[model samples]
Target: MDVSWVDGERRRVTRICDALRIRIEGVARAMTSDQSARTLSAESADVPDGAYSGDIEAVLITEEQIQQRIAELAESVAARYADAEDDLVLVGVLKGAIMFMTDFARALPIPSQMEFMAVSSYGSSTSTSGVVRILKDLDRDIAGRDVLIVEDIIDSGLTLSWLMKNLATRHPRSLQVCTLLRKPEAVRNIVEVADVGFDIPNDFVVGYGLDYAERYRDLPYIGRLRPAVYER
Candidate 1:
C-alpha cells in the first residue's frame, strides 16, 4: 500500500471518530434541555406543537424574535460603516450563512456588495476539525473595502478564527463579524464579533440555514433538536 494513501485513510478515520464524539455530546446536552422545556406549562410555552419536522424539544428562538434582532443589528452595522469612503462588502460563508446574509443585507440601510465563500471543515459530520479548506473563493477583490462577514452561527470559533486571519492577508480596510447565533461555552478561540443576534446555550440547534446532515435549513425558527433524531 502507498504510504500516502494509508496516511489519508488514517486521517479519515480520525475525523469520523471526532464527529461521533461531538454528536454524542450534543445529544446528551439536548436531552437535558428537552427535560427542562417539559417543565413549562402549556400556556407559558411559545412554540406550538407540530411546529417543526423533527423531534424538536423546544423553540429556542422564534422567527419574530430573529427578525426584530436583525433590524437592530442592521441599524448598528449601518451606523458604524455609514461614513466609510468605500462601498461596504458583505462576505457570507456559503450554505449555512445564506439565510442570515440575505436577511441582514436587506435590513441594512446602507448600500453594500455581497460576496460568498464556501468552506468545509467537516464534510457530513456534526463537529469541527479545526482545519478548514476553502471550497470556493470570493469573486471580487476586497482590498481597501470595509468587509463584514455574515454568518449563521459561531460554534467552536475555530473556523471563524481561521477565516478572519485568512481574509486579513487580503488587506481589507476593516473586517468584522456579524453572526446570528453564538455559543459562549463552545468557543475554543477568542473571536471578536461585532454584531451578535443571540447568545444561545451550548446545544445543537437546527433551522434558518443551520442543519444536521443537511436537513432542517428551511425552518423559520431555531430550536433544539430531539436527541433521538440524531442518534438514529
Candidate 2:
C-alpha cells in the first residue's frame, strides 16, 4: 500500500543528484576556460626587454600569425617539391632570412638542405642601395637541384632580383621565391615571388630576422619601427 510513495521518493532523489552533477560539471568547465584564457593573456604580455618594446610603434604581424603562415608556406612548398629526385635546397639570404629559414625548414614535411647566401643591399640604412653584393655564397653547388629562395622581406625587390639572376647561373633544375613579407615597391620590381606570406605597407619594420642598424631582430613578432628610433 505504501510502496508507491517509496518509489516516488527514490525517483526524486535520483533527479536531484543528476541535476547537481550537471551543474558541477558546467562550473568546472567554466573555471577551466577562464584559467586557460588568463594564461594565454599573460604569456602574450610577457615580452622580454630584448624585443625593443620601447622602440616599436606597433606590431605589424603577431608571432602566432607569422608561425601559422610559415606552416602553410611549408606545406605548399613541400608539396611542390614532393617529387624531387634529391632533397630540396633552401637558399636563405643570410642575417635577415635566418629565422624564417630555420623555422620553415623545420616545418616542411619533405627533406631540405639549407644553403645561406649573405647578400648586402642595405648596410646601416633603411633604404636599399640597389646594389647587391654577396658576403657569403652557398656552400654546395645548386646545379640541377630544386632551390627555393627563402627570404624574410622583399622591400624594393632589388636584392631578390639580383639573387634570382645570380642563382640562375648555377642552373638549378627549378628555382622559386618564398618571402614572408613584401612591400608595395616589391610588387613593381618584376621579380615574381612564388609565395608571399604577407603583403605589407611601406612602413619600416623590424624583428623576426629583419632589422634596422642590426637591432630589434630578437623580437618574436614583426613590428613597425618607431619613427624616432630610425630618425635619430
Tens-place lDDT per residue, model 1, 1-232, is 8999999998778656544543344344333421211111232125566646447777888888789888988998899899999778999998999998999999999999999999887744567787799999999888778888899988887777678767766757677778888886434345657677777777789888998888888888888888888888
Evaluate model 1: give its TM-score: 0.77
Listed per model in order, the count of residue pairs whose N, CA or C atoms clash below 3 Å is: 0, 0
* Model 2 ranges off by over 4 Å: 1-51
User: For model 1, what is the C-alpha lDDT against the true structure?
Assistant: 0.76
Tell me the whole-model lDDT of each prediction, alpha carbons only: 0.76, 0.78
RMSD for each model, in Å, please?
11.9, 23.5
> Clashes in model 1: which pairs?
none
Model 2 TM: 0.78
Given candidate 2, what's the lDDT at residue 11? 78
Distance from true position, residue 184, model 2, in Å?
Answer: 0.3
Compute the lDDT of residue 228 as modeled in candidate 1. 87
lDDT of 2 by residue, 1-232 (tens): 6999999998778656544543344334323421211011112233345538789877777899889888988888888788889999999988999999999999999999999999988755877888789899889988778888899988998888788767765667767788888887876655647777887778898889988888888888888888999898
